[model samples]
Target: MRDTQRTILVFGATGQQGGAVARALLRAQWAVRALVRDPAAPKSIALREAGVELVRGSFADIDVLRAAMKDAYGVFSVVPSSPSGAVTDEEEVRFGTAIADLASESGIAHLVYSSGASVGEKPTGVARFDTKARIEAHIRELPVTATIVRPVIFMEMLVRPGFGLDKGRFTFFLRPNQSMQLIAVDDIGKFVTAIFADKMRFSGETLKIASDTVTGRELETILTEAAGRPIAYARFPDEVLAANPYLRQLAASLDEGPLADHVDLNVMRELNPEILSFRSWLAGSGRKALDEALGTTGLGL
Candidate 1:
């Protein structure tokens, strides 16, 4: 059983990763407190309704962050990166390091930082991922009990509209025979919940998590079975890669190995037995997204 008296300070509670973690912590019976820019926003209100204590503020507000961390047993840190153009790489490093420094200074018991799979000892040269690497490095040096989780590509991204699901085809970075790992967003919560549950085993560890590993051909089979129609799977053509520098760089990363197969599924399953594979995700929480991508349903989840 969890200690209901112990609270967790979760950052980015209204966003995808933070929202998932906050909900999972609540489900596990841990008291959750979140800092949000607008407490009246629909997502923020929903979080409050679900029992998360809301603190009105942004990442730039140091006093608010310090106040929220007060008396919290643990902190879950995730910051926005340059990909969204919301914050620059420098700002991301600052926010991440600031959270760690504050958590350490506040005497928080444990700190869990969510990073990208591509981030590692050496820089990947991708500013977004390298930025996470910098943050991870900074956290390791802090006087804090920190655990870093590097999640692979999200299964949800595969079903998004531009991926060609609407045209009865799937276009991604993997070649037909090449394989990559993927994790459902919900499963991220499950893993983090387990981490928070067993700090002794997970603390000071950097875990790479994924629910399943599949090749392009396997994806086609799974999508075809789920959609009840043939969904051709193909890698982004050279012409498309040439036209988009960002896509080209991502594809190069996949081919060169940072974004390729690396997770140990057996270990991940041991941490969270309910982890969802691509097929299982499509049949459950991922269904509506897939339907919308396939043009079988209207927008707005």
Candidate 2:
């Protein structure tokens, strides 16, 4: 189908993944439609300025979803999980499966669902990670042509205000030499745009995507170089992990291998050569955030 005749409906447009997808889709000359909770919000307004049509509604509204899906060639689905506390795990599953069902019923040619990389051949029993696994199973059972993109831990999350950056140190999931895969958020858009542009090749496939991998020691070196200051690196203290169930689960997952990323860098480069490494990201789009993070000290990861 011609780009002019095609529209891709995107959820979470006001947030990271959806925003990236919308921006990339527009740059590629495809009509982009976003389902938003507030059309008057700054992000939504920016989307409008950039030529995205906005449909104001929530996932709970069936009529809103139907209207947004009308005449849309593809649907890029990424829903908020337990982190937002905007919904429970059951609610997350309900919304996710519902979107797939809606897309199928709407006759969408392609449906691309973004899920977490931690999901594996079996459920990890982590609420956040397992939630996507459930969603993936539901999408697979649907009659619609679908693609599942499992993204690793976001590179952006590494440089957030907390996590000891202000104290001239960094604490994360991996040991000093244990590598973890990470992806730049914008690259997610690049990948999805390619998938939408070539539906036949991507449909029915589940892809694990990561731009780069780095160990904790590597993160220390990279951050120090980027910040032009000394920044030590260490794994989360056992005491801290033991106290926080969430952090403890994540740390355990890393140790056990389920949370560890196994994406092939060479193949991902072929798919998206513009993908940024951790240092390149800190040098580029991440510069401002890193600068801000280094200037403040917040608690927790």
Residues 1-301, model 2: lDDT tens digits: 3365699999999999999999889988999999989989899899999999999999999888998899999999999997898989988999999999999999999999999877888867678888999999999999999999998889999988788888899988678988888999999999999999899999899998888988889999999998778999998889988887777777776777566647789999887879999999988998878887888324222
TM-score, per-candidate, Cα-based: 0.95, 0.95
Model 2 earns a TM-score of: 0.95
Instruction: Candidate 1: list runs displaced more than 4 Å.
Output: 1-4, 242-245, 298-301
Q: What are the runs in model 2 whose C-alpha is more than 4 Å off?
A: 296-301
lDDT of 1 at 161: 87
**Could you give candidate 1's per-residue lDDT for residues 1-301 as a string of tens digits?**
5565699999988988999999999999999999999999999999999999999998899998999999999999999998888899999999999999999999999999999887756766668888899999999999899999999889988888899888989998788998888999889888998999999998899998899999999999999999988999999889999887667766776787577647788888899988888999999999998999999885432
The lDDT of model 1 is 0.89
Query: What RMSD does model 2 have?
Result: 3.1
Whole-model lDDT values for every prediction: 0.89, 0.89
